[model samples]
Every structure is written in C-alpha cells, then in structure tokens.
Target: MLTALGLLPLALLGGWSLHAAGDYKEREQERWMLDLARALSSAADAELDGTVATLTTLGSTPALQNGDLPALYAAASTLARAQPDWLGVILTDDSGKILFRTMDSYGAPQTAAPADPDSLNQVLSTHQPVAGRIARGPRGRAAFPVRVPITDAKGKLYTLTAVILPDRMVRLIERQQVPTDAIIAIRDGARATVARSRDQKGRVADAPSKSLVELMRAGPEGIGTAVTTEGQQVATAYTTLSRYGWAVIVGRPTDKLRAAAFERMGVYGIGIALSLLGCFLLASLLANRIVRTIEALQQGAAALGSGAPLTLAPSSIIEIENIGKALEQAEHQRNAQERERAQLLDSLNRALASHQTALADAREAGRAKDEFLAVLGHELRNPLSPIVTSLDLMDFRDEPGNRRERGVMRRQVQHLRRLVDDLLDVSRITSGKLQIDATPVNLADVVRHAVTTSSGQQISMSTPAAVWVMGDGSRLTQVLNNLLSNAERFGSSATQVTLTVDATHARLVVSDNGIGMSEELMARVFEPFQQAPQSLARRTGGLGLGLAIVRKIVELHHGEVTVYSAGAGTGSRFEVTLPLSAAPAPEPCAIAAPHVEGLQLLLVDDNVDAAGAGAALLELLGHEVRVAHNAAEALDAVRQKMPQVAILDIGLPDMDGYALAAAIRHQAGDTPLRLVALTGYGQKEDITRAYEADFDLHLTKPATVADLQRATAPLT
Candidate 1:
C-alpha cells in the first residue's frame, strides 16, 4: 500500500508534465505560423504600395501634364524597362480611352482598352490611387493594374496605370521559404488566388477552397482548420492587409501536425511507463528511509530560513544529500546577489553621471564651434574688403600695360570671395538655417549671367526663350558657376550647357569633356569633402564642397541634381531638374541708372585699411568721402556735416554700429540720411538686425563696385 501510494503521485506528475510540454510546443508552433502569415501579408502590401508610388510619380511627369503622348510614352517605356516584373505602363482618359501604352510602339494605335477599367473609374472618382484586380493583361498573361489619377492645372482628370505581372508576387511567397508540404498563398479581395507557393500551375487567379473562403469572411485574421484547394486538410493561419483588401494564408498539413503530436505522446508514454516501473521498485526500498530523511530535510530547511550554516551529516540517500548541498548553495547565492546588486547600482550611477557630463561637453563644443566660424569669417573678410576696394580703384584707372595683371588680381579676389561664401553656406546648411527667397526666375537670364561671370573656356549654350522656375536667382547662378568651375578644374576643353523646358519641369544639362570620374568616385561624389585623388601638387584646388552645396541648394528648391560619367578619360555630364512655375508679369523695362556718383558719403570701419581704401574708392568714383576709424569719430563727422549716406562697420572700437546708428539718427532728427551697414557679418540674423537698426542697406565685406553702387543708390 505504501509503495503504491508513493508511486501514484510520481505517475500523475509525469503525465501532467508531458501534457504541458506538448501543449507548449503546439502553442509555439501556432504562434510561429501566425507570425509568418503576418509577415507575408506585410510583404504583399509593400509590393502593392511600391507599384502605386511608381504610378503616382509617373502621373506627375511633365510630358503627361502637357499631353505630349510621344514623350510620355518614351518616359514610361524607360521606367517599364527598369522593372522586369512590369508588363507595361498605360495612360487613359477619364472615359477609359487608352492614350498610350509602353508595350506598344510610340504613337502606335492602341485598340485594346485598359485591362481594369473599373479601377480606373474608381481612381478617377476618388482622386486616390488604387490596386486593381488580376485580369488578362495586354500580353495575354495574368496581371494586375495599379492606377493613380493625374489632374492638370485646369482640373482635367487622367489615369496612369502600371500593369504588374503576378509572377513577381509568387516570387514574394517563395522568398518566405515555407515548409515543403505547407501552403503559402496571397488572395485578392475577390477571393481569387493572386499567388501561391504550392501547386501554382493552375492555382493562380483561381478561387481558394470554400472552407478557406468562409474562414476569411469571418475575420481579417484568424487560425482554424480548413481544406486547401488541393483537397488537403490544413491548420490554416491567415491575416489580411489593411491598405488593400488582400489576404495572406499559411496552411500547414493537419496530418503532419497530428503525426508530430502523436509521436511526441508515444515517446512520453514509453518514458512514463519505464519511470513508473522504476519508481514502483524503488518505493518499496526507500519508503522506510524517506521519513527519517524528510525529518532531517525539514531541519535543514529551518536552518536555512534562519540564516544559519547547514550542519546536517551526509546521508545514504542521494536526494537527501542533494537537499543539504542546496541549502549551503542558497546561502552563498544570497551573499553573492547582494554584492552584485550593489555593484550594479554603482555602475548605473557612474553611467548617469558620465552621460550628463558628455551632454554638457557637447553643448559647449557647439557654442565654441559657432564662435570660431564667426571669428574666422570676420578675420578673413576684413582683409578681402581692402583688396576688393583696391581692385575697384584699379578698374577705374585706364593704366596701360596692366590689363593682364588687373585681370589676374580680380579673378583671384573673386575666387577667394567664393570660397568664403561657400564656407558660410555650408554652416548655414548644416544648421538648417539656409532659406530660399523664392521668386519667379527666368533660366535664360540666369544662364546668361552665370556664363558672363564664369571665367573659363568659352561655354557653348542652348536655351529656350524663358523657362520660369520659382527659386533664388543668385543661388541658381551659384549652382551653375560651381558646375562650370568643376569642369574647368578637371581639364574640360569643351563644355556644353543646354536647358530644356516642358509644361511642368525644366532640365538643365552641363556636359564636359573632362577627366571623367571612376565608379568609386561617382558612388560618393555628392558627399561633402569627397574628392578625386590628387597628386602632391594638388593643381585642382578646392575644398570638395561645391557639388555637395549644389545638391543641397537644388533640394531646397524642390529640384534634383544628378551626375553621370562614362568612366575615366571619357567625359562627365551633370543634370539638374526643377519644377516649373508660371511666369510672372514681364518685368518693367529697366529703370534709368541711379545717379550714384559725386555724392557726400561717410565710410566707417575699425580696420583703418578697409576704411581708407573704401574712402579712396568712393572719392575715385567722383564722390566727396569722409573716413572714420571708430563710432565716436563717425558720430563726430555726422555732427559736423550730415552726409547723404553713412556706411558703418558692425564691429567698432567704440559703441557698436547699431547704437551709433541710433545716436546718429537722434542727432539728425529730420535729415533723410541713408545708413548702409558695410561689415563682415553676413548671416541672415545680421541682415535682419541691420533692418531693425534703421539701416537702409546691408552689404558684407568685399563688396564689388556694382554692389557698392547699388547700396549707395537712393532708395526708390
């Protein structure tokens, strides 16, 4: 009786444990199958979303907006060629008349209408993209259409469709690598199989089993037993995509799952039988010893609870001995856990302190960097201002035999100024402070201005009358100059520039027969500081930031720039595409030039050289000029005789330019004096401050004769 009693609980425990293990394995398998179904559903959604995006982009193309069927066909053909799974691209009117198809030759008559007219109608009605049902494509294969609606400026609607092959979706299923006998399938909203992993020969575009359809109708996702189209019973897990009314079903054969469970149960049964037999035999022998051993174990447990050392002697039974050993180990683990927790707390404290310190250091470093850039710009421009003034002075003189020297000096000075501007622009770009002063700008005028200012090999140009785009004209000019400069530096003998316009976009292409880039250089060409390999001499001098700036500025204008090169020694081509804007009213004929010469002016700069050279340049320009080295001197001069204009430097030895300007305004209460801020600070904030301080104009250091003349011109 005692042996049986002891063996009974052991038998029950073995059975319970085996049942729990089986249940756990089954639950885990179900969870995995459900997860797989969700993953497959997500993949299908991504594919459909990608097709829709492509169609949307194509719908916005300039050729389509302008109703240029041939150009639209060509563009669509190029896109279709890039995607192997794309059967063709189609365009249709709101009434479903096929305008063009990439599968057909350009301008070829198309008799067949779009494969899915209902989806096209839906898109036209909703003004939203749609994923159409699988149907017989133009190629007489199973395909589906993704449609996006395009509306012209006059609100006329058109549809753009991309016919996609179903085989690509089957490829998506194959990539999941489901079990050999398992079934993975994607079904469209109409309960037809779009793609299947198994028995796909005649299964695609065919309806799934009635039972699976019933399960799909029950919910967006669920797990249940269903029969597949192949007449095989399966444990099916399914999920439906939210974006498109589609379903992804993963079905594992029920027979296989059952076989696995039964096999595990059989193994557990045999083990349990053997264990019961062994326990029956041992129970007889161990029952008598168990009571005494249990008493000793109880004592050890009490001692352990009291935090006292275990003092139990060795026992004949292995389990009793193990119990004593466990008690001792438990005491040791307690001490170790306390020590580990203390160390962990200390580590966390140190880490938190370090993080705070690093954050403060980072903020301080940023502040210091900003200060350094400002100071660097100030120091660099101070010297260039005097140089620019001297160059202007030379321009006024008709000195013989000095034209070449004068040209050399002027070019170098302009180059230095560009470098400074590029440096400052980079800072603004990184800090996200750069802004575009958008206005209707004519590309023809921009190209002309850039060509005249660019000093290099004569550039061949071809442009239409006027291609208007909303952007900053000066920034656009900078983009062109950078491209021209890049060509010149790379040894281009012949450079050609072409501007092509359409109703919605303008494309500017600059091609040069230069030292073309290698594949490695092209890969990272737009990254800042990326440059071609140079010798020690480094004849091509640049900071390698020109292309980087070009890309950023173009992006600001909602445009794109790309570079293409046919390997080294071949050539390189750069293309910039910007969205077109409606041309503004024709600018009024140029106003008569302002009489800027022979005026009374006051030039103030803390740098004596800058002030003196500026004064000399004004005097040479047939103007009465007075120079001041400080704000106090400027005020004194203004008090003595109120000049027509006062050009004050922001950085002064006395009160700063803003305060001095206020004082001067107070002194000349009624005098209409124009205050032009001529300083090295050229940031956006500095310009804003100039206006706020009542300054009529703001010009950075190194202002050219044209810039100075414009600033000194009477405000209109």
Candidate 2:
C-alpha cells in the first residue's frame, strides 16, 4: 500500500509540471504581441507629431502675417508638394472658415471655404493645438486634420489646419519595427481601420472580431486572447496613441502555441511512461528500486539549470553513477574557466589604469615644460633688449676707435640671440605651435638680403633677375643664415657656397672642404640636437639645432633641404631647393624718412636703461623725445602735453601697454594718438592682444632705427 501511494504521487507531479510548461509558453507569445502593438503605436504618434510640427513652423512665416495671399499660397503649395503625406495646408479664420488652401486654383477665392467644425472649436476653445478625428472631406475624402492656433499681433487668434492623408499614414505603420508576420492596423474612434500594414483591412468591425476592440477598450493599453469572426483564435493587443479615441492594434496567430503544446505533451508523456515502466519492472525484480535514483537525477538537473549547487545521493545504478560523475567534472571545469576569465579581466583593468596614469603624467610634464619655456623666453628677452638697444645707441656716438670692439659685442649678442631663438623654435616645433607668414617672394632678393645680414664670405652665384617663390622672407633668410653659419663653423677657408636657379627650382648649395660627415651623422643630421660626433659636439659651441631649424623652415615653405658627403674629411655638400613661381611678387614702395624735428614722441617704459637709451637715440635722430619710467609719469606727461606718438613698452610696472593704450584713448578721445606697442612679447598671440587693446602698430623689442623712423615718419 505504501509503494502504490508513492508511485501515484510521482505520476501526478510529472503531469502537473507538463501543464505548467504549456501555460508559460502561451504567456510568452502574448507578451511579445503586446510589446509589438506598443511599438507600432509609438511610431504612429511620432509621425503625426512631426507632421503637425512642420505645419506649425510654416504658419509662423512672415508671408502669412503680411497678408501676402499669393506668397502664402506659393509657400503652402511648395510644402504640400514636397511631402507626399501632406494633402494640403489651410488657413482658417476664428469662425473656422477656410481663408486659403494650398489645393485651391491659383488666384482663387480666399473666403467662404469650409473647415472641420470640431477641430475649430477644440483649437479656439482650448487655445491649444489639437489633433482631431479622421473625417471625410466634401468629396468623401479620408484625411486627419491637425489644428494649430496662431495669435496675431493684436491678439486675434487664427487657425492653421494641416490635412494628412490616411493612405500615406499606412506607410509609416508598415515600416514599423515589429514582427514580419505581425498584422498592424490603425483604427479611428468608431473602430474603423484607416491604415494597415497589409492591403486587406477595414474596420475593427471588419477585423473579423468586435472582441478585439472591446478587449482594447478595456484600458489605454491592453493585451488579450481573442476570437476572430473567422473562428480562429489569436493573441491581440492594442495601445492608445492620443487623447482622441484611436488605437494601434496588432494580432498574431494563437494556434501555433496550441500545436506546440500538444507536441510537447506527447514527448513528456512518453518519457514519464517509460519511467513508470522502468520503476515497475525494477520493483518487480528488485522492490522499491530506481525511484530515488530517478528523483536524484531530476533534482540535480533542475539545480544545474538554475545555476545552483547540486547534491546527489549515491546510486547503485552504473548509468546514473557515470552521469553524476560526468556532471561533477563539467562543473569543475566551468569553475576553473570562470576563475581564469576573472583573473584575465583583472589584469586588463590594471593595465588600462596604468596606461591612463602614465598618459596623465606625460601630459602634465609637457604642460610644465611649455610654461617653463615661455617664462624663460620672457626673462632672457628682457635683459637682451637693453643690450641690443645700447648697441644701436653706439651707432650715433663717436666711437670709431672702438669700432672692432663694438662689432665683436654685436656679433656675440647676435649669436646668443640665435641660440635662445633656436631653443624656443625647437620647443614650438615640437609642440606644433610655429606660425609662419608666407607670401610670393623673389629668391634672389632674399639671398642678397640674407648675405647682407650675415657675415658670409663671397658666395659664388649666377644672375637670375627674379627667381620667384612663395615663402616667408625673414624666415627664409634665417634658413640661409643658419646654413652659412654652419658651413663657416665646420669648414676651412677653402670652403665654397653657391646659389643657382633652374627652370623649376631655385637651389642654394653650401659645399665645405672641412671635416665631412660619417654615415651615422649624415643619417641623423636633421634630427634635433644631433651633432657630427662627441668630439664635434664639444668643439662646436651649439646645441646642434641649426640644421633642424633649417629643415623645418624649408618644409614650411614647401621646399626641400638635403645633404651629401663622402667619408669623414672628404668634403660635404648641403643643398636647399625651393619651387619657383611664375608671377612676380610686388614690393612695397619705400617711404622717405621724415624730418625728425617735425616729430614729437612719447616713450613710456619702466626699464630705465631701455627708456633712456631709446629716447636718446630718437632725440639724436632729430626727434623731440619725452621719456617716462612709469604709467603715472607717462599719463601726467600726456595730460600736460599730448605727444603725437607714444612708444609704450608692454611690460610696464603699474599698467600694461594695452591698458595704457585704452587709458590714453580715453584721455584724448578721438584725437588719433598713434599708439605703438614695443615689447618682448613678440608671439602671434601677443601681437593680436596688442591690436585688440587699440594699438595702431605692434613692434617687437630691439627695433631698428629704420622701423621706428618708418612708423613715426608717417604720423608726422
């Protein structure tokens, strides 16, 4: 009696499990259908709202307000013609009479036109835009009208109505991202289908089932099992799209689950029957056998499916023993793989963290270096200015006996300036901040000018009246100067440099019969800070940046620089080639120097030496000069006697030249003081800052007499 009871309970439990599985399958299908319905409904709402918004924007156009009926008609026609879904755009009065319609014949009547009375009331009464029911037109045309209320300047409310085509709305529903086999349809308040995913559709009354609408009307969104008029069972769902009584409906066949459940039940029944037969046969042979073993397997499989721990009692059956052991092995391997994957993920996370830290450190280091260079450039340039000014001051004095000494001082200053400039250029180029002003240039003129500026020996050359190329004249001269200086530093007196021009290129060649380059040095010659050898680096008093600067400048001009050499001491050749231009660049006509006695200048600078020396030089050149060491003194002098020209050093103590320029302009409003900013800040940003501060001209420190004369001469 006890054994029979146990067997009966086992059979009942197995049957109940099969029934629950079938119910879950049906629920899954219903959920899917419900989601598809909502998605389709959302797509429909978006399309309607977009059409309404476009028409509202059009109603705001000035053409509608100006009472330009023809212009308004033309614009509305264009809008309607562009959108296939928009039937027409109509303008209506407060009483709902159509004032104009895009569909009307050109030059047609603008009054007595009909509009939907319901839409007009909702728009005027609510004073808000609203979408109304899909209604029939005069010719029995189906369309959805959206009403937008527009208030005029005098607070008169007008109605702008847009008519949307129903068939075109079907296109939006058909393109929705739902099941390919889903039956999608949009319905009106009366449950009439206005659009469908497929061609065959009419009313919810025509949907082969009134129950679909009744099920949907239960709530704003609903899902239910419904029966169609065709006597077919289906999963149906519907969702509300707007305040109006309209919905999107979706249906999927329910028979699929019914057939599937039947098939699954048969399989389950076969498996359970075999278990019962096995138990009875095993019990007849060996009483109460196979029950616990079967139960263990079932429990273990359930735990494994749920990713929970499995514990199985020992079984005498060999097959069950093997299955348990195999399962145990699989669990162990899975645990090992999980551990390995976790370790790998941890390692990857650590590596990513390390890389981010290193990247941040590198960026910080770069920023610190740039700040250091900027500060260093300013500090070095300030002191260098006075030295450079004093050199120019020497030009006016009777110091012929000290001419060689003066020349030496000037050359040393030039060398130091070049070295500092080279370092700054390297920093700028490395940080990608070098700015160059390129223009059409005559290469011959640049060469002559560079030679005049540098201490180059007689260079061999052929005459070309003008070998035109586009380049920065000063930077190109700097490139030539660096090359000549390099050759002079490394080569003997026997060295020769030459310039030649061809049809397509202008070439400058510097051939040196000195210690030529080895293969290694030549390979790395253009690399910054690369010298010929350790011995050469010690012998040459430079950071080996000249060639690098030369190469950079040439590349900026779209030109090329190359080197050729035999083994050490055999002779080396450096060649620079620039592209030629056909058209000649125009040169500015030289302005004649003004008589200094006719000029009055104000010199404002906190640097005592720079201010006094510059003023003395200007006075020596016959200009009436006034000097002030601070802005207070400068302002007092300006107030006492406003000078025609003010040369203000930007790095003043109390106020910067920019602020002083503004103050001066305020003090002498519209009197046209020729403000000139002379400062150590010569970068592009500094020059732009000067202009924004109201300076008429910006000159870098250590300006030649020619620059100041030319600048001040014009004012006189």
Which number leads on TM-score? 1
lDDT at 529, model 2: 79
| Local distance difference test, candidate 1 | 0.84
Q: For every candidate structure, what is the RMSD over all alpha carbons to the true structure, in angstroms?
A: 35.7, 31.7
Q: Write the per-residue lDDT of candidate 2 for residues 1-716, one digit (tens) a residue.
A: 44456776886787788788789867877777777777766766777678768877877778777666578778888998998877888887787767778888766776564555766797889987776667666776678777788765556677887888787657767567665656677775556666766653333224336777578658788788776555557778777755555677777777765787888778877887787777666667654466668787889878887889988788888988888887777768866997899999999999887997889999999779767765676567767777877888896795889889898998888888887788778777777777789778887887777766666354554446677788888898888888877866775455455667777888988777767888888989998878776564465577788999899988988889999998887878889999887766466999776455557789998988888888887887777999998899999999987888899999888987888898888898767579999888877889999999989898877677776775586553
* TM-scores of all candidate predictions against the true structure: 0.48, 0.47
Clashing pairs in 1: none
How high is the lDDT of residue 188 in model 2?
59
lDDT of each: 0.84, 0.77
- In model 2, the worst 10-residue window by lDDT is 199-208
Would you give me the overall lDDT of model 2? 0.77
Lowest summed-lDDT stretch of 10 residues in model 1?
A: 370-379
- TM-score of model 1 relative to the true fold? 0.48
